[model samples]
Target chain A: MSFVSLRNVTKAFGDNVVLRDVDLQVDEHNVVCLIGASGSGKSTLLRCLNLLEVVDRGEIEVDGQTITNGQVDVNALRRKIGIVFQAYNLFPHMTVIDNVTLAPTKVRRVSKADARDRAKDLLERIGLAEKADEFPDRLSGGQQQRVAIARALAMEPKLMLLDEITSALDPQLVAEVLTLVRELAETGMTMIIATHEMSFAREVANKVCFLDEGVISEEGPPEQIFSAPQQPRTREFLARVLAAGRL
Target chain B: MHEVLQKFFSPHAFRVSLPDVWTGFQLNLKLMVIAEVLVLVLALAIAVVRGLPGRGATPLRALAIVYTDVFRGTPLILVAFLVGFGLPGLNIKGLSTLSNFTYGVIALTLVYTAYVTEVYRAGIESVHPSQRMAARSLGLSYWQAMRYVVIPQAVRRVIPPLLNDFVGLQKDTALVTVIGVAESVQQAQQFSQNNFNFTSYVVAAVFFILLTIPLARFTDHLIRIRERRERAQLT
Candidate 1:
């Protein structure tokens, strides 16, 4: 079975349909980058993976464990899946170490010493050991996002979901977050990232999925998806993204 | 007139007996403490009940609304009278009851809990839905979210307003005088009546101003700090 699968996933809000009949899969030990225009359901799809936004109808399975039917204990399901958002969403009142340590202590039942040690290790790995004592609001956007990554890593999640983590940062700050993501990719973390960073997607992702109107327009190795996309819509979308020159 | 002048200019002019003042002050302090503690607990209960999502919320909310409105909208004098006097007539047999002092505290809690409930609600709602989602997604149940994440932030945000409510409640303890609770204001009045002078009234005014001004200024200072931290985050 695929490590992560979304089968016939559909999401709607009132009269607006955001996603429909979406089927996708991510194998273990691979990075899958989802790229699309704004409001093309990219972020919504990532949210569904972790069940942050409940799907109207569908099944989402991570590590062959189904969570979308609402049968699974959401906290248990979420413990194995980590999510980082564009806004960083770090608890402003908490220090970087505390933000990273909270889930491990609460969900995993780790001792305070162990949680603190692990948080410190992750902060060091992210080049943010100096920030461990600082509250999130005191950190730069780049540093805050790195702390967010560490916070997610503290849960020891098997799957990490990235929803435009760098889009909210300054242009110079974007590279630092992307570089950290690149390091995660190199370490064989199974990740599904929804992003507009075409260059990073082209470099790190083993596979790329181009979503349009809540359906995968094309899916293939990064070479085929980026260089010679099969779908005209994918090409047009990439053309616009390239012209924007953010990559 | 010379004797009056002598009384005014004597070193004993402002001499308040510590034992006597302490007795009245202790009672006043006790009443304020009791009323503040009860108000916080009752407000928390009412807020939780109002926050619940069921048929229970309706009646609890109604009760909370009526409790707050009747106490806050009308004078505390009326509520203290109704609780201390009016309830005695019903005299439901075998129901052990509260004393005038106890009823006064209850009355203060009932009135101010509603006011503080709104403060808590505003604080709780000010927390972005994302914060709750983050906490829940991190494996906290709803109650756990409130305990570990939401309530702490809400309480922090509501502190200044909650303190203001508390100070207001402290001052309102004087209203219990109608029920014959000898708190500071009542004691001061009695002292003045016995002495046939306004010295006791001036003393009470001095005591109140001394208590409230510093607290008001301190809360204002805290609010400014919170705002400064928020503004610093933006930059």
Candidate 2:
């Protein structure tokens, strides 16, 4: 069985339907990239997987556990999955080390000393060890995003969702955050990345899915999806990306 | 100008009335401190209740809204009179045993709690919803997010405004004068009647100003420090 599976998932905000009958499968240690235009339900899909948004209709199973069933403990379910958003929502009131260690010490009941040690390690991995004491607003955009990722990884989640994590970053700053993500992928971390960086997606993603409006129009290995897209929508998107020099 | 100064700020009259006015101002100090403590605790509770999610808290939210609205709209002096004379007039069991000073404290607490509850609610709401989402995503329960992450930040942000309300509360402590409580304003009125000099009222005014100036300045200092810190982060 796939490590994570979404079956006919549909989500809507009031009358504005953002996702429609989307089915997807992800295997262990596979980096799946979701590509689409803005408003193609990519963010919402990621949010639904993390149960941040309740689906109008569907079932999601991650690691053989049913996410849609009401019996599952939502908090416990979330502990296994970590999501980093575009805006790098670090708690501005907290120091970097404190932001990363908060969940471990409070929710996981790890000793404060142990959590701090683990948080330092994560920060070190992200090349932000010196910034552990700094507040989020004091950091550059890329640095803040890295810290946000480190904060999510502190939980040691089995799957990481990167929702356009570099979208808000400057062109120069994007590479630093992308480099960190690339390292995460190389280390065999299972990630579902929603991104606009086509080259990065092609280089890192084992599988790429092209979404249109609210549907996954085409999905295949990156080599096939990027080079020879089957769906007309996929081809048109790639053409637009090419014309804009993003592909 | 000389006559006005002599009537309002006469040195001899001020010195004569100082001891009596000082006694009355002590009551004002006591009322303010006690009322402040009560307002802090009670207003926070009400604000949290009002922010409670889901239909189960509908009645609670309604009650909180009504309480804040009614008390905030009513004049502080009227509330003081109602709490003081009306409670004893109720003639309930063991009601008359409570002193007028305690009644004054109760009245101030009720009105200020209403005002500060809105302040607290505003502070909590001002914290971006994304902060709450980030906390919850980390596996913290709703109340845990609020208790540890949200409330501390909210309280810090609201401190200047909170102190602003207390400054008003300190001045309003004189409202108990209407209920025949021996607060500074009442003592000043008595001194005016006895000596036919308004200098005692000046003494009382000076005492109020003395207490408020330090607090008002402290509040401004806090606001400046907070702004500087926040701007430093932005740059």
What CA RMSD would you report for each candidate? Answer: 2.8, 1.7
Highest DockQ model number = 2
| Tens-digit lDDT string for candidate 2 (A114-161) | 999999999999999999999888799999999989989999999999
State, as a TM-score between 0 and 1, how close model 1 is to the true structure: 0.92
Give model 1's docking category: medium
Estimate the TM-score of every prediction. 0.92, 0.96
Clashing pairs in 1: none
In candidate 1, residue A139 scores what lDDT? 86
> Against the unseen true structure, what C-alpha lDDT does each candidate score?
0.82, 0.93
Candidate 1: what lDDT? 0.82
Local accuracy of candidate 1 as per-residue lDDT tens digits, B1-235: 7776543333343355223444666666788898788778777777765666568468877876676666568767777787777776677653226577777776677777778888887888888888878877776667877777877888889999999987897778778878877767677677656665555555555666777888899999999998998797677
